[model samples]
Target chain A: MDLEFSPEDIAFRDEVRKFLEESYPESLRGKASRDEYEREDFLLWQKTLYERGWGAPAWPKEYGGTGWTSIQRFIFQEECARAETIPIPPFGMNMLAPVLLAFGSEEQKQEYLPPIIKGETFWCQGYSEPGSGSDLASLKTTAVRDGDEYVINGQKTWTTLGHFADWIFVLCRTDPSAKKLQEGISFILVNMKTPGVEVKPIITLDGSHEVNETWFTDVRVPVANRVGEENKGWTYAKYLLLHERSGIAGVGRSKRAVERLKEIAATEVSHGEPIIHDPTFARKIAELEVDLTALEYTELRTLAAEAQGKGPGPESSLLKVKGTEIQQRLTELTLEAVGNYAAPYFRGFPKDGDNAYPIGPGYAHMAAPLYANMRKTSIYGGSNEIQRNIIAKAVLGL
Target chain B: MDFNFTSEQDQLRDMVARLMREQYDFDTRRKIASSEPGWRPEMWSQFAELGLLAAPFTEEEGGFGGPIETMIMMEEFGKGLVIEPFLQTAVIAFLQGIIGGEKIFGFAYAEPQGRYNLNDLATTAKKDGDGYVLNGHKAVAHGGPMATHFIVTARTGGDQRDDKGVGVFIVAKDAKGVTTRDYPTVDGQRASEVYFENVSVGADALIGSGDDLALVEKVVDEAIAALCAEAVGCMKVLNEATVDYSKQRKQFGVPIASFQVLQHRMVDMFMAAEQAVSMAYMVTLKLGEDDVERAKAASAAKVQTGKAGKLISQDAVQIHGGMGMTDELNVGHYFKRLTMIGQQFGDVDFHLKRYAKLSAG
Candidate 1:
């Protein structure tokens, strides 16, 4: 096995490097560098990629994808991440677009794919409910069939970016009497602007309104909005969860976090020396870097498998279980590196929207919120516990 | 970037794994650890026949394979909890072009007062005409009981704790003024407190010329990487053993693996093990790089493996209940080995500081 990029791949990398250097917006970079980006801050860079015909790297070519090889896609992501660019939200692009292309009807495809490609429509997942998260198949959300519409009634909690989303893909029970809990589910798409739909904010420990509780009462969803067959949505839902978990590995982002931590540690002082000079603190950074390198190699191997026509399968669970935890760890170390500056309003509340005024170094303010927000990574995308059981059954046959 | 091993490497690993499963079961290993000299000569010859002892040296050094090969062998050895000095003798010194024959080698560097500092040597080797007279004590010389020769680090010119003026000398175990007090370590391996009382050695005994301390440090870093690989292998076993135990041991009329809390803990252990494996691979990848990058990778791997080892070993025993604590169970032994691995080369705290110092530069 060879790790060195081919001459052609190296040329492509140069091209990507040039584009990032020349076209990446300074204002968006400013916001992203501080973890204070709004939806628009994220959309700006995504729209730039869309214009350059590189928005969705993994989507099929027919669906406005770049059709780059797996290594090239990896390079593109590595470049974007290393440049500290805001991640193009996964819901509409990486998550929903894949499901739609694979399962959505031609009309559904024609309507949704282009909007997602252009970053004109924002989407969020409505899979988790207050009473049902890891045991997702046991969701109580109901979609009763009407003349031409399904009356939806449910509350979806931990609906990340729900306030900003224009539409949400939901899993609802269409047949309660089915033999298995999973068999009775139907995958339906709902407009957030429907009369009975409400988005109520749930401020997390970091005091950010990043997630919301979405209430759906008598929401009218047309039968045409359903993905694949009714009462067989479990199949589609499982497919979507795989895509979601696969992308949650966050290897690129963690690399950026390491870079940021190094920068902060090099500047922040403890006992008359930069904290980075302190063996204890530096070792912590080094340890994180080591863990990140491993996750990254695993991610690359997963990509190679994908290149060979294999879906993520249980490995996605491994990635999700490890990736999100690594992300959480970087934030924890960042908070620790910033020292008492991470004190003010940390886990207290986000007084402002997403941006909080700093008490010390410019980097300190983002530490607390980033750490608190990252806590959701393990809990969502199926709690790490469920992923292990999946590994036990599928990988180990235990 | 490419994580796939060559067919030869794969074959080697599989063969070693087969040997471990067939001949080095826990009971057999326990018997060996309890025996005099604390290791088996037949097993050592078996390793030599398998080319495991020669895996880290180049052909010019009269051996086949490289660091990757040695890493593969050490990992398998770790899985079996093999109480041999293959790492102590082969990878540690053979890489330094020091090993000559079947004679076991011991490194005498750490002292009574020298916590983790390689330069804090009170062991002095002053010149007396063509030969040098050495006088000092070396604490915790790993593999000491089995060592037929010793690689002793002594200060020749610089002050105590200074990095400069350090040198390494090869001394025979049966030398006139040498003494060793040997014992089994916490992890069931043999170590010794070696005393050097005006031991004389010829000028030919000096291994390398400049900055011998630095050379020793780099060699120790390689040893640390090998240890990290070994820890990863042990963690893999612990994770699997813990999961199997959970499936068999019933609690509240059901298998404990079915408990959500325990399941989550097991997953955490799995993640730790997997991450350690990843870091170990990374260290192997960075093995022959320039000193700074190599040291960074070693320290990073050391930290991750050390932490992961602790987490996996502890959780494995905790989940196994009282049976995990008994001498009859392999889980507790694995924990003991992991604990020793953490403290070896350098513990998490020590390497963390070293990592920070390097990053600052």
Candidate 2:
């Protein structure tokens, strides 16, 4: 019921703010704000956070975590959002680290957890196949166990950041004739550099190479890379998805978008007044703030529940549904605010590219691309429709 | 910040929702809207008994609820599509009126020439020895016929479109030299074009003297937030109803829900409803803040709700196909109400401009 931060919380917040101001890279901040960053830029920030012992706030305390309370974690996230720092890739940290901690053998944990925390290794998910997207259990990808190795052959589509990955954690079928579909699957980790493994780029509507289709043809994976028991991939995959969906709310980022929207509106003029003053445009910003505020509350509520030792529950589905849509809307509104500058296609963005001169205000360059990229939010981390079905069954008892 | 609703607020919402469910069902609402007053007196009394009428005012103003409580109640009322003048009678009038008790109230502010500007008033009330002589025309005064009292905005000293010198006066509905031309609005609620021809009122009738511009703006903003909440409720119903209909109605020998295109459209409609709900909650929470920020938040909310409402209602009807246009179906009524809600206070375009102006220092 109380929103006021305690004196200790305020002190902690100030400490975190001081650290960010002092340590966050200046050059990295510029690239991050514009959302034009290389893998090295992301890892640089991750290394700094890791060095400060704040690498994985959600990780168990034993796994190099800060062991901060949920509220403190929320505060740190809020600060990161306000700072608009390029996000550390989620595939390695939030998604795989938790599964490794829960299901990995001692050797697996010792070998994998350290590099992941230090940002030395990159990871990508190999769950979705061409025909097995929403219905992931129907995946035809198989890995036959032969002696001490499993020969894998399959294609995984929509492999986000697969080109940047050193390794991939896949859901592969080890038993094709099991009584149930979900029971035949096994979780296996594979090195991206293995023989017969290929990563083909997927240039999306935004003309970015952020995703890839990874193909595995008779790639041999050691049995030691299997997580937990055979035929238990679905359980691990579901667990990883829960971790993924919990943070998909993206409250902090959306708040930043609102600030960005205000900045753009304050500068752009229409009929002699700043567009922000134009009731038509100002109203859109105001309405967005409202939706963002509600979403902020919903996220905080989820955090509060987590503070009480409760998992995200079905409400995470609600968050994913609303959060992604709001993100999409923010980008759409941003593109609208930028006017004709958001021409859906850019000849060259930076100074040295094909088109010599940048088109509009530096801020307007990313608006259209960001809008197109955000479409994946609703589709990925399990599509929003699947989340709705989850809500219907779990929350609504349908 | 903590976002959990207090148990009391949750209980209040539940109570209002239950009452709407049992007594204010769609059939009863249709009957009441088609009747003489165009709203139910019994329902108004019940709301009064439940303190719903006094929920938006402060404790100093003899009311129990704050802005948050008002938001909760309004959201429930919105869900039920309640035809009562809670916004006009309680939110605008009770707060602005010189005296308030059992009587229903209406706001006579928007002039024929003023458009959406509350300050653009050609209506003038010249002061006499103890009272004022009022002469003006007020267009689209919602809840006009049901209200026993009227809160009229008039220009006392400034030019027709000036922001200053505007006064709020309380005029009795039965007063002499007053005329009201009443008709049903598109949303099935009653409104009026009220006229004041040399109408006289005592000095005591001036609740806020000619310079209460901020007060007028705040009240209107609150009303706008409440209306946004109502739109969110209607959008919620429209989305669900459309989905249900799509699942049942077959095309190409399969239910329309089987089509991926229609499913994606439903998802879009659902997201719009969710975003509208979020924005409505946001604006309602901002209602009690400092004037500029409050106005800015209100306009932002109005814009979002208007957009989301339009998208959801129109998409709902389109998904439902031809039957969606019929009066027998509830989607058309929701669409009509949603359309009117957008035009209230200010439409999306107007609010966007207002937000831009207010945002600039």
Candidate 3:
């Protein structure tokens, strides 16, 4: 019945807050936006957490995880988002690890889990292809098994952080002759530096290289690299997608963005007053806050259900759909608040030895790009439309 | 009672559509938008040759058309998501540069302190001898970088927000004290933070005399209508593109368009685009009405178009899925342009309140 955290949880929140305050790397302090984050920046933050034994907060305690309670995990995530920490990319820790934990062999777990948690390697997802985004089971990436290894061949587009990733978890068609399209697919890992692997950056509309089209021209991988039984990777992938959508409802980050939006609006002038003073702009922010509150409660309810030993169900798709809409709306409002400054597109702001000052406010540098880039939220992670499809069929049984 | 375009307007649309197809395809437009000048002077020459430069002026002013011509032209421009400054230099303002394709022009009305109020100008032109000395920053002057000349707003008499003091001045971009920091906009167009430090202009440079806020507002209303027309172009293109894409793109062994859920969405997009087309035309028809009616129509059309643009663009992107996200596709370009148009002169909320006020009165 209570909405407030327990006393112990509150204390744990404070402890985590204090830990972030003291231990968050000094270099990563002001670089809240992802534009400034290099591979080293992410590694620094992840390693800092790894050093604190908090790298994989949601993993089981036996798998080098803190094994915090669901509420504690929620609190930790909230604090990290509020602090605007560079997110630990989900490829290794969130997506692949869960798949590995659920379906990997003992040798695979023993070999990979420690390096993943220790921040020794970066992993990128390889489920999507040019022809196979929403229709993921129709993927054409093939893994023809050699005597001792699998010869993988196909291109995986939108491989987030593929440019610098140490490894990629690819979904390959191990048995193309199978009766069902979903049945032939197998989740397999590939090294990015293998003989035929290629990484070509796909510049987004924002003119930034956050994702890439990763090519594998007959790359080799040991047969041991496959997760779970052959022809059953669809089950494991669906499981991972469920895990992906759970955190896609980014209420914590959206709340922080709201506060940031308010600050920008307060500073931006409209009719001799701050834009926030304008009833219309104020109302949009208020509506956004209300929407975020509803989403927060929905997330909290899911977390509570998890605490009660129930897994997040098809309803988590609601969070993905709504959360992405809210996030997109945040970008919209931010661009609105920034006003005419949104016109200026900075390809790379204040690059090395380029001391030319940007034309507008420092906050405005990334406003439009972030707005353009944030469109990926709904499109990625099974798209908001697919999520809606999930809600219609799975939730409503229509 | 007539919503149909005149024969001339239809010819204009057909001509522009042909030029856009032949010369302004998606890749060419993208290249020019990112090129050294960020726009095509040659395109301006073609527009000028096609009599587009003088289309908005009265017949007395030696032009064959009015806002309707702009509406027709901008709609086609929207379909291509044309990156050139036709909106900036023609409908939004104008370019005498069309002759030699040399003298680009921009409208500098917005100020740092003025959100959407066309009258809230802090830039001033205090009279000195045969000219006036101008000093103030014009925020994000549309087509500012390429513009060799600017139609700027400055206060001649009263305080910042007062409607009575505003004066319009056409100043040369290279005026002694003028400086510009040019940058490409998010929508792949170019703009500048144009600063005026005692920049001087002759008395002749002033367009029509004192208290020009009403003139500015009227021009803005026309511009908003023109923008609405352009947005409808974007929405219609996007809606159709989404339909085409969904029909081609398959998921679950059928075109995603086959899903009743998606079918409903495309229907919504189509309907929104249709309603927006009606509003754009309505506003154009009302552009010559009395002040209050014109203002109301403009605001109402802006609100309709802005809200419609949001839905159509987002849904278009959503339906196209990841392909919509890539800069390689035309969908994202159209989406970005539609997004920028939402906040161009006044956003949906601003126009909503404005429409409400005018309606009450």
Candidate 4:
């Protein structure tokens, strides 16, 4: 089987590369790669992309998106990743937007889609609670109907970008007596500014403030905000979870990491020569490259299936498990390349400060931080252990 | 972009699989194991007639002009416990394709003290007249008992540790002062050690001499790919046999396959086999590229496949209970073949160390 891209796809890739090279601000690229972007800086960067009609390539054009084919979208993302440009955050665009497009009422889509497209509103996910990760149906979040409005009172921990969000899509139990656990849930949207909404930072091992514990107490949301039918939130949640897991594959980002690792290996000396010259290290890189190649092919298979107008089946779990593993390995290898330079634990280094003593190179300060930050990949979007179980049950019928 | 075999390749695989099932059954394999040289010439002739032996070589050398992936197909054949010298023949064909000659060649690099290191040759080759006089003994030469020529490696100039000075020679197996001690391995394969007492050969016998240890390394790496592919095939058979036995074999008033934990273990075996197959395919694809890159990819596949083969074989045996360890069952044959394949072209640790060194660069 061949692995070469079509000439047209290559040309599209070139166009994407050229656009990213010219349009993506150097400051944002540097900060994004360093995992040091502030909320405002991210908004500004996303707005610039939105203004250029380059944001949300995977979304439909009728909803202020580019309406690209799956391969084109894949190409766009890969180029952006290889160029080290700021990524369009998945919470709003990749995760919730698809749900809004497919299941949200027309007026609801009209109200929320424009804001997301214009970068006027940031979104966060409210799927997981204290007790409901892999066994997500056991969630304790509650939404009670009270005349024209529903009061949402629950807590969502590990809320990525919750502090910056103006809106959130949550899955809460709307039916206490429904027979099946999956039949008692409902999907609803809530404004972050609603009364009694609070976001408390949950500091991760990386010492980053990207995640938070969001609590909603007596938060009022109009009945119009509910997506689809009542007690059908599990269906919508499953749909959204697929989107989340698919993006979690991170094929583009891993490709970029491999490139950056190669560059660093070429420059860094290990045994009186560039580390890239070391046969062992080169072989390790090559091994990762082979894995990355296989992952890329698997991704293409998924995309090709989507192009044929089908949602991902059990094979998506395979992609999710292997893709995240590869990304984790890439991050580990990146840190390994930096060696002792990545050993220092810089807690909360400012994004725009001059106080931090940059380690090894300007690029290396983020190695440890990136490694620490990515520790949650396997935990979120379904843990690898959970994915294995899914594979065993769904694909192998075991 | 596509990850499927062509219709022709598909038919070829199916044909080979059917032929293996019908003609090369377990009883036939046992007979071959007990034979004089532990191999059947009629089987080799059958493969040659089927054009399987010539699939991986070029038409210029009486081959099909196919790529290394063709050789991978033959490797899978070896995994079915087929008692034949496919690897020995394919490797000779591959070297002949590269060296551009009709001369028969058998690899003579592994030494008693070298420990699977291809470049660690101790034999010396000194210039005498218009040729070189080889003075050393080569051990564990597969197919050396029947081959017409020997592709011998000898220390020329550099230090023992210096891989740069190793030279490769194609010496006639029947040359004067040549002696052989042939025997059967535990896996029912024949191999021999040959002594070189001033065995002289013309300068034309040298394939690619001098400090080109890289080429020598490539030959070894390619051989590893072939061996890994064979192991993959063997693992596939073992996995399928285990699954079938688990479904049919009963225990505690029910089929053993009804157990969830055992099913999960079998699923894991399937996953390992699938991953190994994917990596082996990739290694075959990269075989004709840059030497270092090829070596790196080949070593990764070799490492992964070697380890996975061992695990799957062991698990297959465990799934069959006591029957798996007995000589009457085919599962035991796969176990022995997998063990032999592991040590054939540098074991898992050797490849992993190689992979780590290349990656650490």
Candidate 5:
């Protein structure tokens, strides 16, 4: 019932704050604070946190993590988010690691865990095929059994960070003739360096190459790399999807964005006074703040359920839908705050050679890009429309 | 931070909700609305007996010592379209208790030209020998016609636009030269315009000495909180009614709820209700603290609740199709109540302006 942390937790928070102040590289913090971190910068930040034994605060201590309590983990995340530090990539820590910890063989854990903790491996998800997003069970990615290895052949579009990834975990149809579409799938881990694997860039409307089309052309993966039971990959996939959806709540990042929005609104002027002085805009921010506060409570409830040894259930879908909506609203408000500074399309901006006077700052250069990038949040992970269906069926029993 | 009510709060809510549902059903409300007084005094006495009337007041002032959160629970009272003076009575009770008054009281703030601004008072109270002579007319004064006493805000010195020098007085409803033009509002509740023509009051009538405008502002802000809670209640009913009607009513040989568009809209309605509930709860928690903070939070809730209540009620009626607008239908009651709730305390634009001003500062 109490909102305040204990004295010990407060002290722990102070220690974490001091460490963040001293240890996070200034250049990396600058990029993170500006929301313009590159792949290398993110990796270096992750490695720094890992070296300090502060990476993956949600993971068990035995897995080279902090193993903090749920509230402590939440506090750490809030602080890290508010501090504008680079968040550990969810593809490695939030999405795949949990699945590997739960369903991978001992050898698989030993092999994947260390590389992930050491920041030596960069992972991208290979889940959504072109025709099989919300209806994911209809995926046609085939992984034919070939003696001691499976040959994967299919395309995974919207592969976030695929261009930077060295590894990919995929769901492929292993037994096409199984009764249920879900029954035929198997989870496989493949190296991006395999001879037949290819990645083609998909430049988004934001004119950023953050996403890619990953093609697996008979890419051979070891049988030992298969997670859990063969053809039972649907279970593991569901587990991973829950983790992904839960992470998509993005409470920490959104809180930082809200603070940034407030700051920008306070500084940016419209109608003579700062835009934040406008009641309409300020009211929108206040309403968003209140919604974020409620979302935080909903997230804590879900985490409390997990702390009691329960997997994320249908309620996580609710968080995903509302969380992404809030995130989109934050971006919209940020663009509104930036006003004319955010008008130049990223593609229209000069990139090389002679004419290259940046319109505002590097941050303003990414506003349109970030806005365009966030357009996929509701579509990926699972479209909010699909999440509502899940909530209707599972939570509301409609 | 927990979002759950304590077991005792839950029990209290359940008891009040049940009493409202059983005793103040739509049929009973409709019957009372057509009666001479427009509201049933027997029901008010029943609420008093159940301690619902005293729920938000302190024990020393013939009340149950309930926090503002208890007023939020009273939102359910609005859901049933209960025709009683819970809000008017409770707010006045709290104010009177705070200012050391023993009698039941009612608020008189809204004026014919005030629009929705509580600060736009044209009333004047001039100092007389050992007392004050009040001269003003107040509109939409809920329970003013029946209240034992009235808390009337009047400009003592400064200009009408200046909220400073605005003083609040406790005048008995039966004070000399006081007259009430009472009538039933569209929501089937009675409110009155009380005219004070040189109505003199004793020294004790003044709640606080000289121009403490902040106290008057605080009272108005708390009254807005009470209204927001009631609006949340009204919207909750509207949401449920919409969902239920959409589930049962069939079109094209299937329930309308089967359509994704309607489902999404219902989800939106649910979200609005959820946000309003959260904001109302937070404002209730801070009610006893900072006045400015309470004003900001309450305005936030009012803005959200007012808009949501209107949207949900309108959509609920539309979802019910033709029967929704009929006086015979219960959903229409919710619709009427929601409309009334929006206009009460302050409407969406009023609160939004207030919120913007506070946040801007």
Candidate 6:
């Protein structure tokens, strides 16, 4: 009944705090902005965790996981936020590894797990295509057998970190004639260095390069790279996404953000006083915090259930919905707090590559860009509308 | 009390709509946005040729009309997603163009710190003998790359954020010590980070008597009304696009528009666009009203436009799904424009507060 941490959990939390405080490289300290973190910076963090035997806390212990309870995993993510450490990209460890453990062959696990653990490889998910986004089952990227290899040909867009990745696990259509659009999809891993594969940046509204358009022109991949049986990638893909949705509540980040919002309020002036003095402005923050608290507990309850070996259920859809709404509100408030400073755009096709001087306070620098980019939070992984539909069908049985 | 446009205004709308529909397709707009000058001079000439740019002036000035004409023209521009600077050059900018009466201009009022406050300026028009020495930067000067000149706002008499201190003056784009770093915006329009370092301007460059915050505010309110019409136009296209997309995009073996939940969303979008339509008309007609009434109408209309624009744009993209995120699709561009429009003159929050204040009085 109590939400208090047990002695063992407190001790684990301390160990995590110490590990992050000491092991996190100073060179990459505050420089690890989201998606802007270079390959070396990410590798540095992963390698640090690897040395501590904490590379994959959520993995099965036999396969080099920390074997901690879900609560411990939650504590680790929170501590990382408190420490302001760089976020580990999820494509490899968080996403691919879960699917691989559940559905991959022995050879696939042996080959991929070690590199993922050691931070020797970068893997990106290739589930989305230009034609298929929310209707992911309609993806048209094809992979056909050509003797020992499969000739993969198609374009995948919104490929987050595709430029930095060493490998990609793509969902390719192996049998287009199958009755269902979801049918005949195969999960196949391909080396990024393979011939006929190309990567081009797709700059978002924020003018940042976090995603890319990856084109594969008859890229040849070994047939053995396929995970599980033929025409069964959809099941594996859904499994990976379910794992992602459970963690997407982003409780840790939003809590840190509420504090940031208060700080911004205290600093920004309104009517010759700090905007926090305004009852209406303060009330907005209070209301947002109240919503966050409810979402946080909902997430905590989910984690507690998962700790008891109850796999993340469809209720993760609720967390995704509320969590993203809170995330977007935080950005919106920050944009409001910055007053007129949100207009000074920092970079504009850097003439000599120096667009250094941003207008106004440092807080205002990322406000507009972050607000622009956070629109993707609701749209990606699965849109909130889709999550609602999932709740309607899966939870309410409508 | 009337919502109907005058016959002349109707003709103007039809002319602009036809012109835009023919020459300003999505592909054409994208090409213009990416071009060297960032906008077609010929388009500006065409606007001048058709007397569309002269909508701000009286008939004797060889112009057709005023606020209502602007409303009609900008609404059409919004539908076509016109990337040119008609709002800046015609509706909001000054008239003392030494180049020609037909010379194009960009309005450069936004400072690095001015958010939506026209008075919160760091750019200075320091009194230097018979002229002023201008120094400081303007952020997001839309149409900077295309304009032969710019109408800039600066502080002349009082401290920053003081109403009495703001001055509107015309500055040449290629004036000595004036530098423009140009680039395309998220909404497929070109804007610049324009800098002035000790650039000199003649006393005649002042638009009004200088240091007229009321004058600045009046222009801003007028611009707000015009922007609202544009937003209304944006929302209508977004709503139609979403509804059309829903009927065509099938999932689960049926068109998504058949879903009750989605149909309700489309209905909400339709209502928002329709409300925006009423507000656009209300604001345009009220531009002739007193300051409180005019400002209130502008803010009230803008608040609705901002809300409608957000809901419609976001839902438009949501309904269109992944195709909305791509550059190839016109939906994302509208989404971006509607987004930037969300905060252009005053954001939803700003207008909400402004409307409340005006209401209290």
Worst 10 residues of 3 chain B by lDDT: B92-101
Weakest 10 consecutive residues of candidate 6 chain A by summed lDDT: A342-351
Candidate 4 ranges beyond 4 A from true positions: A1-4, A350-352, A355-359, B1-361
B1-361 in candidate 3: lDDT tens per residue?
A: 8778778889989999998899988899898888788888777778778877777766875677888988888898888777666666666555344433456678888887787888888899999997888999998888887787888999998988888989988888988999987888889888888899989788888887867888888889988998998898888888888999999998768888788878999999989899999999899989999999999999999998988998998888888888888889888899889988998998888888888988998
lDDT of 6: 0.83
Tens-digit per-residue lDDT, B156-234, candidate 6: 9887778887888988888899998766665667777889999999998787877788888888888888888888778
The local lDDT score (0 to 100) that residue A239 gets in candidate 6 is 92
- Better model by DockQ, 2 or 3? 3
lDDT of 4: 0.74
Clashes of each: 1, 16, 1, 21, 0, 1
| TM-score of each model, paired residue for residue | 0.55, 0.56, 0.96, 0.54, 0.54, 0.90
True contacts kept of each: 0.01, 0.01, 0.76, 0.00, 0.00, 0.10
Instruction: Write the residue-wise lDDT of candidate 2 on B309-336 in tens digits.
Output: 8788757766655345444567767776
Q: Which candidate would rank higher by lDDT, 1 or 3?
A: 3
Clashing pairs in 1: A279-B353
- Model 3 clash number: 1
Off by over 4 Å in 6: A129-132, A138-157, A172-185, A195-203, A212-223, A262-267, A270-276, A344-355, A360-362, B94-102, B121-140, B144-162, B165-167, B171-184, B192-203, B207-211
Output the lDDT of residue A85, model 4. Answer: 73
| Candidate 5 per-residue lDDT over residues A30-124, each given as its tens digit | 56654545778777888888889886777778889787877788778878887888778789888889999899888888899888887788999
Q: Tens-digit lDDT track for model 4 on B140-231? A: 77766656667778877787657678887777878997787665554556666778999888878777764557877887777777777777
Model 4's A-chain: what TM-score?
A: 0.95
Off by over 4 Å in 2: A347-358, B1-361
Residue B278 of model 3 has an lDDT of 93
RMSD of each: 19.0, 19.0, 1.9, 19.8, 19.9, 3.3
Q: Can you tell me which runs of candidate 3 are displaced by over 4 Å?
A: A350-356, B92-102
Better of 1 and 6 by lDDT: 6
**Each model's lDDT:** 0.80, 0.80, 0.86, 0.74, 0.75, 0.83
DockQ top scorer: 3
